[model samples]
Target: MEFRVLGAVEATADGAPVDLGSRKQRLVLAVLLLDAGRPVSRDRLVDLLWPADPPASARGTVQALVSRIRAVFRAAGGPELVTEGPGY
Candidate 1:
């Protein structure tokens, strides 16, 4: 499994590109990768995902994005997305 954030946020498995879904999902993965091995708080993610006004469903949106990302990794037989405390 390889994650690239230098040029563009990208994930590849076995040399094949891994689809990361939407732009927001990719951003979530990038943020998490930047803080790898550390638990990123939900509030922090909310702020990053929506800097101006975060809707009431912002938390759920993050979770859904994480879930989608995890599914992609899981299907690709890559790394596991670990959930720690209030974050993923």
Candidate 2:
């Protein structure tokens, strides 16, 4: 998948369009792109996605969100879009 993130999110796979709906999903993708392939920490993702107060399952939610975003990338014929480590 080749993505261009300027004012909005747009991704194409083999010259075909890919749809990644939902505001939260967009937000997650936006943040990751903003980081320019750098691994985004789980804690940071949780905080950024749900500010003020987060749910008890915030961590899990962030992970699920990331997984969904990665699925979109794969569907677009791209490699796994995100990587995790000790810190990013």
Candidate 3:
């Protein structure tokens, strides 16, 4: 699969378009791609995905977003791109 993020975020698998899921999922991937090869903190992801009032389920929402993004990358035949570590 190939990912295009220099412009709008897009993913393709075997030359066919691959859906990355929802808008929030795409945003999560977009932010991570902007800082590719690095660890993006969960807090930062929360901030980017929910700038204003965050729901009580915000953490779960972020987790789901990350999982979906990871699935998209895997479906595109790419390596696990987002790695979580210290402060990330």
TM-scores for all candidates: the values are: 0.96, 0.81, 0.83
lDDT of each: 0.91, 0.76, 0.77
lDDT for model 2, on a 0 to 1 scale?
0.76
What is the lDDT ranking, best to worst? 1, 3, 2
lDDT string for model 2 (1-88, tens) is 7777787787788888788777777887878878876788888878888899999998887777778887787667776664658323
The parts of candidate 3 lying over 4 Å away from their true place are 86-88
lDDT score of model 1? 0.91
Better of 2 and 3 by lDDT: 3
Q: What residue pairs are clashing in model 2?
A: none
lDDT of 1 by residue, 24-49 (tens): 99999999999998998888999999
User: Model 2 Cα displacement at 33 (Å)?
Assistant: 1.3
Candidate 3: worst-modelled 10 consecutive residues by lDDT: 79-88
Report the C-alpha lDDT of model 3 over 1-88, residue by residue, as the tens digit: 6778877789888889988888888888888777877888888888877899778888788887887777777767866764567213
Better of 1 and 2 by lDDT: 1
